[model samples]
Target: MRMLKRFFLIPIVVLVVSCGGPELPEEVALEYEALPKTLDFNQHVKPILSDKCYLCHGPDAGNIKGGLQLHSAEAAYSELSENPGNLAIVPGKLEKSEMFHRIITTDPNLIMPSPDSHLSLTNKEKAMLVKWIEDGAEYKDHWAFIKPEKHKVPKIKNEDLVANPIDNFVLAQLEPLDLKLSEKADKETLLRRASIDLTGLQPTLEQIEEFVNDESPNAFEKQVDRMLASEKYGEQRTLDWMDLARYADTHGYSVDRYRDTSPWRDWVIKSFNENMPYDQFIL
Candidate 1:
């Protein structure tokens, strides 16, 4: 598939705790073809922790299972009383890092995500954690919770080709790589792209004809407006929301019986078409 627009690099932030099956050996082999120069704490480590460790060791103070807390850097790295050593993680020294030792330990009793929890880590995840600690175990705020900031739009040589500040930002990245943006698609192509993206269907012949013949500079913008207001827009967005909600084919339990969720699904489509605010949509 051809990319319609150049995508600029954007830094993402997520708050997650590391959770994996077992500790890795002090001399663990890296799974990557090349080791990353820098490991992102929020991206690589947080999700693993969030999935496996957060229930017992996260922000909820009352539910903290062990005295150890891995959600925050201050807590995760602090010395724990149960372990022989004081520090849970010792930056830049994997062998001395107690957290690293526990996961890599072959002793069944000593492995984390304890056998009872039925959680396990892949070799790749273990390597990432190891690399992260070796890189100094830095922690930062989760990306989502951070306040949104306006970034300075980058300057690019292809100023005439850019449609917006976003395009300028994308072009700036491409300039350094010695790459250039593809030519804009014709009006008929644009119509089809917009239709499929927003409504999951192609533009009709008449719609294509009208768009191609229109000479107005804002013709494409009008088409975008049309798709956003279309009934199919609601349907398309509802399908995306379904994944986020973890909608499944059957009841996710022992019985695994089929169930009806059409009403709930329909409500989602209705809310989307109504253009509900993000906070209200979650509520």
Candidate 2:
């Protein structure tokens, strides 16, 4: 009887010991929760900036702008914690972070690097970076840090109302923000807007008359399409491409020599008329 009672009592003691084991402090549990499970350096951050920024802010380059070098994870964190002005990064805190503030800044004087570089961070990119910083700024591998996953196009309820896939993408994001597309403008308003946007000038009386006369629902689209197909569009596109390519009438050398590249310029204009894809033209 004594032996049987001892066996049953042993089981009860084990159960009680397991159930009443030591508990972790709330603060310690919170600390563990705060740590990021993983980090994505490339997708989360790198695409937000370009090589133009890397020129001065990279490891090899001189740390010119606010002594903040974003070349490596170590360097980035070091600057964040040790900056005298406290104006670069603030790890694990996005709102109180100075790095984020600089990127989203509209003030020309406060802009990063203060250079003529045309590279600008997009709003979406800024938001992603802020979220990343808030998530502890975990250091991980660069590009291809993670395997790519297939993305599916989201389904919309009103297929009849959809104009384009771009609209769908815009709507998907905007819906969460409680925003909707603005109502379509009147024909006259649209024609004026289209003319200025397409040709960089106000519509002529004849153009306006033709647009007003057309009764088709697709008239405005057709008119804009026609304008896009015009020789004027080709000419403007060529000039714009030239500006992008930084082509000048004269050679930029030590002596600032004058060189005739008119034949090349004409060739570029002709290619535009042929509706050459920019990538092919670049090649």
Candidate 3:
């Protein structure tokens, strides 16, 4: 799959933090990667920490090494009570920050992710870490805990092709790249697609003819409603739920024994048919 990357450009002067502490070896100093846009904590810095540093120093207290925690600013920015004046991180002070020193250290005893652990960081990751600290190392609550904010829908060049708000969002990204949505599917094809999607069955010849002949503005929606009302819709939807919930029909202790578990499967189908709320269904 191809990845689409978008950058938000903001004009601001970049400040290089003064290197005030111990000098690193020439080989240890990484080439600085310039920032054209403000670094977002959740999007940029959190991912790097989660992937490379989180396993030992993250949420798992028993596994934590060096009494160091980096999951949030409150936990990490404080001076340790045991060590009177030492601190792990000081936002916007790259040289004073011990974490950065440990990252770029050459001493086998001091370097992290611990050379013996076989975990390593790419030059890009190292450069990003440096840039983040220089930019104040601001932290935000995890996305799951934050309330969502709404923004105005983007205006696109090709508005006629848009049928809904989602289409506008898609076209906003594509218009810049000279890309467009594929040609609209014909009525017969659309009916078949909708039937298969809703009921996991292809449209019958009669259903296709009726859909193509209806010629009403809401003909497609009406056909979708009919498919959704069919018993097969519940059956089709239940297949995924069955797989996820590990619905089984046998007890095997080195011997495969068969037992009736159809009632549980029926329950899932019934829940779908009744349109049970997701939380209620899960519970």
Best by TM-score: 1
lDDT of 2 by residue, 1-283 (tens): 4532221222212112223231223443354344345436665467454444676676664354446677666777663333443434567864455565555455554545344766665444555565567677765554433556666666755455568676777677666568778887887888989877666667788888989999998888898888787776666767787888888877855677778888888888778778776558877
Per-residue alpha-carbon lDDT of model 1 for 48-147, expressed as tens digits?
8888777767889887754678888898887653433457677877655666765655555555666778887676777777788877888879675567
TM-score of candidate 3 on Cα atoms, chains taken together: 0.58
lDDT assessment of candidate 2:
0.61
Ranking by TM-score: 1, 3, 2
Question: Candidate 3's C-alpha lDDT?
Answer: 0.74
lDDT of 3 by residue, 136-247 (tens): 8899987656777886899998879988888998998788779989999999988888888888999999999999899898898899889889989999999888788777
Whichever of 2 and 3 has more lDDT, that candidate is 3
Best first by lDDT, ranked: 3, 1, 2
Q: Whose TM-score is higher: candidate 2's or candidate 3's?
A: 3
Best by lDDT: 3
Clashing pairs in 2: none
Q: Least accurate stretch of 10 residues (summed lDDT) in model 3?
A: 1-10
TM-score of each: 0.61, 0.49, 0.58
Give the per-residue Cα lDDT of candidate 2 at 191. 91
